[model samples]
Target: MAGGGVAGHGASAGETKLPPLTPGPYRRRLGFVALVATFGGLLFGYDTSVINGAGGFMARPDQLDLSPLGLGVAASALVYAAVIGAFTGGRISDAWGRKRTIAVLAVMFIIGVAVVSIAPSLAVVVVGRVVLGLAVGAAAVVVPVFLAELAPYEIRGSLAGRNEMMIVTGQLVAIIMNAIIGNVWGDQYPWVWRIMFALAAIPAILLLLGVSRMPESPRWLADKGRDDEALEILESMRPPGRAKPELDDIIHTREIEKQRVSEDIGKIFHNKNLVRIILVGCGIGFFQQTTGINSILYYGSDVLEEAGFGTGGALIANIAPAAISVITALIALQMMDRVSRRKTFLVGYALVAFSHVLIGTADVVLPDGGAAKPYVLLILIVFFVGSMQLFLNIATWVTLSEIFPQKIRAFGMGLAVAVLWMTNGFLTLFFPTIIAAIGISGSFFAFAALNVIAFFFFLKNVPETKGHTLEELEEHVTDGSIFHSIGRK
Candidate 1:
């Protein structure tokens, strides 16, 4: 259960006693709202997997005619732009509101995807990707925070994690589409990659129409002194008796944040506690990309081709990792609260390290063009992706969303994810070069070494964020209490 000492646990002198929490139709309503918001996640996923197939098509002789370096440039443009979007989007979410920020991003997604689908030149393609990258970066920062603020602490992991689930689902959709299109029309059709890029516009449209009907983050309402409105939203989403107490907690935390002048990024450095928290947040974001997951997602076919499969065989085989991501991500949703964050991360990095070692060893030993090489490499990639989805991806986002105090939550999360996107951009830009220069054996081995470092990082820094309301967690962060334990569930 979520921790005690919640506000309104004992009525203040003049406060009326509230009734016990009860289930009602509003639970379904909240679920619906969550589903609508997660379309952004689907868009995120589609954007990821679409590149896997589309990048290959775009670089063909008759297409954009990109060089290896140019391919990296075009592929990483959005990611680089996303770094800008992530931080600015966080500030925008604070100034405007989470709901409005998402609405604006939805419009950007449509525009960005449309631009990419029709680009006749590499320059225009990079331009389109930059536009879409902004939306992706903003969504990465805002969506999980929106879900976290709205959900009850006990089930917050599952609700907030719906974004990641949708992300993998989007990846799944892209994989199926890529396999079908690559197999059927790849040779004959010149414009099939455009179709893949265009598909993202559908969900972007849905998000625009749907978010208008959804409620704002009640915590944001509370932070802004709109107590009645905040309480109304909380009442609708939370259990009856639980809403008032949670709102009280939000209000109380907001007061503490004000005392410390918490929203200022510079002030964060002055406070040792917040500095520590942000470091951990940035570390998780940094290490997530360093795992080389995007190398596989953006260039899976290329990885398989190197492993000794034909182009067609590689495209089909790439689906295996995508499928594993969805399945294990589902399993992750169940484990989010049941498993400790530190333990999940420790185990996840360990698995990733082992998988990389196995892959690198196999690649080194297998003869060139060996029949079994692709099959063995494919299995190792599956394990790598499955562990990532289960332990790192969903869990990292959830922790970032919840770790900071109410006043600086948006800014803090933005800074952390900006690091994530920036590192992701750097890796995506160089992955093909890395693979070419080092070969598969050396590339995977390098990542394996990085994961070994990541294991120690998780052990030393990450906090236990489960089973605590956002306010309670804030108290822990402010006082440096969370650093004391490993959440040894």
Candidate 2:
């Protein structure tokens, strides 16, 4: 459970008692609201990853005449835009409130997808991707905060982590959808990409409408000293007798956050320990992308086709990894709260990094085409996706939410995710060129090297965030033991 203590100044001592928290419908209501808002995650996953399926069609040797470098940069622009969006979204969420921030992002989602759907040229498509990237970045930040604020401490990690799982699921759906449509339509209609872009608006519209009916993050309200409002919101999420303790915990959390922000960010920066927290948060994201997971996800069809599969074979093969992601995501959702975040990350990185090394070795040994060679690589990639979703991807997002202090939670998460998306953008934009130059062996080797670095980093610094409430973490943050002791107990 979340901890409690005196939070700087003094907590209010009003005569009014907090309402009781109940289970049943209250918890269900909160879960429902979280699901609705998390449509942003779905769209974020679907819209950005849709390009992966489309890439084969767009940059084919006979199609758009795109160079390897051109393919990469076009793919990368969206991620770069998302970095900017994620960074700005953090500050904007602070000022605008979580629900409102998401709404604004939904608007961006609509417009960005619209532009991409109607794009006349590759440059215009990149423009649309950039705009869509911004929305994805903002959603990545806001959705977790929304879920964390509303969920009970017992379920917070799992619920908060659900957004990421949804993101992977969305990507799987988009990839499948793209494959089905791209084959049937062929550019005779030329509107398949448009449909792909426009489909995002369906989720965006759902996000806006769902959020309109949803309450704001109670922690945000409580931080502004709106205990009554926060309690009311919490009540909507709890049973008749369960609201008060939860409210007390949330209020306790808010006060500490209020106190911490009063310190200077620059002064905090001078503290080497805090810098370590910042570095780990940023590094987690960097390593996450450098694993070349996105390269696989955003260009699965192309990668498969390059290895001697037909377009149809490539599409079918692409679905295998995506299925692995969705299945593992469902399984991981069940384990997120049960497992320690650090252990999960360690396990994930070890498997994925090793898979890359194995894939490289396979390329060297198989030399591209026995009857069994593509089949071997295909199964290996499936195992890679399984390892990624089961451990690292979910754990990385969950740990990011866990590692930062509440006061700088948004700042830390936002900056880390921005750095993540930027790294993702650069890699996505240039992967075609890189793959062309170094081939599969070289690409996997690069990923393996980075994941090796990531392994030691996590073993040394990453927190274990299995059972603690955000409030329980307050003391560690204030005392500067955030890395030393978090997630251990």
Candidate 3:
């Protein structure tokens, strides 16, 4: 209401207006907040991907003594637990405050790491993993939302997108640590995997300490009718002149939302527009996972082994794709504010689908045990990881964080990311068996087909969210006008 006209596509007359992007004196504070909150992302990455290297050692007869399926179950235990975490995390954040919820998750992370690192048996390890999974799942739902609600609209995409960048960064760190620990000490100590698992606690401790000093989400405060407190926090994040205007915008939007929809979660089903948007959010999560990125992150060492690398070689080679993910994720941060979310989704899915087909074809054409086969597949896998990180991963999380209106932001994000984690857990659980049964070529072929479907889904259903404020987007979303802007210049 107090700012300039909208500058990007999909804006029509009488839409919710946005203030200019003046971060003011407190921009440094905002940056620090983003950095601290993304520890959640890093832990998410480390906890999930560390197992890629550790799993092999854990499966040895002297260690956890796991069969292939047992290994899958063990690896996916945290993921399955995350489904419940994601489902419950949103509601918890809504009621408990985002910062407090994140702090609780940090404690959970520490407890989980401790449990897994010292476990004497697979059952105990799984119990620990389930604990970690709950933390990861909750972080997945809350961190991006916290960032989005706190960030200025102009840079919200990049700020919120930082979580994914951290996620990939955590993955890269885990891969490197796994390689070093596994190759250097694995021969003498069968339980070196515990070291890898324990390292996650450092970051978890840091996150807990950092978040304890951080402010609650201003948007959350305003929703709970604490305008003075919300405004104070917002002023620290926004320019002097812009903070009040933005608070006014948030309050006005919340009032409109309250008048239209009851606070009850079930009321969401009664509103057709909310239902459609929730489905779209879930679809975005579905497509992101269907690309099979996690399969590689979670089990790249095994994939490389399947491609022909020895154990040590596979462990070292696993770093390549993860390194590429970090590099591309940095590029994605630059693009987030400038690019159209819809276009980003479409390009990501197309490239991912193509990469899958190439990997599948290469696997078929390259003779078994040939020297070139593994290298060729590694290059293709790097390409696939790069595509997904640059386009899909950042876009998917940012969109989910920003799309839902204030009243239901937590619920919407929870349900959507629950779908995401559920899909990821499913793949992580059975990927070993799937790869054994069908081989990389067949599994990738299946992923390619799914990505193709994903590409079309984005084209038809997803709307551009490039230059709109959350409040602005809310008005269009509730009235079902957001989709009308799809394919519009």
Which number leads on lDDT? 3
Per-candidate local distance difference test: 0.86, 0.78, 0.91
Give per-residue lDDT, candidate 2, residue 69: 66
* Local error of candidate 2 at residue 251 (angstroms): 3.2
Model 1 agreement with the true structure over 1-489: per-residue lDDT tens digits? 125344454433123322444677778988999999999999988886688888788889998888888888888998999899899998999888899999999999999999999999999999999998999999999999999999877778888998999988998899789889978998999679999899899999999999989899998888888999999988888765777766776776677668876566778789898888888889999999889888898889899999988888888999999999999999999998787877888999999999999999999998887788889889888989998898888998888888887777888899999999999998899888889999999999999999999999989888888877787788778878878876444
The TM-score measured for candidate 2 stands at 0.92
Candidate numbers sorted by lDDT from highest down? 3, 1, 2
Model 1: lowest-lDDT 10 consecutive positions: 11-20
Clashes, model 1? 0
lDDT of 3 by residue, 1-489 (tens): 113233233334235455566636688999999999999999999999999999999999999898988889888999999989999999999999999999999999999999999999999999999999999999999999999999888899999999999999999999999999999999999899999999999999999899977899999999999999999998888876777867877777777678998769888899999999999999998888999999999999999999999999999999999999999999999999999898899889999999999999999999999999999999999999999999999999999998898888889999999999999999998998899999999999999999999999999988888887887888888988888888783
For residues 11-124, write the lDDT of model 2, one tens digit per residue: 432223334233477767777887888898899889878887676566655545556666676677788888988888877898788989988988889898898777767788
The segments of candidate 1 whose C-alpha lies over 4 angstroms from its true place after superposition are 1-4, 8-22, 487-489
Once superposed on the true structure, which residue ranges of model 3 sit more than 4 Å away at CA?
1-19
Q: In terms of TM-score, which candidate is stronger, 2 or 3?
A: 3
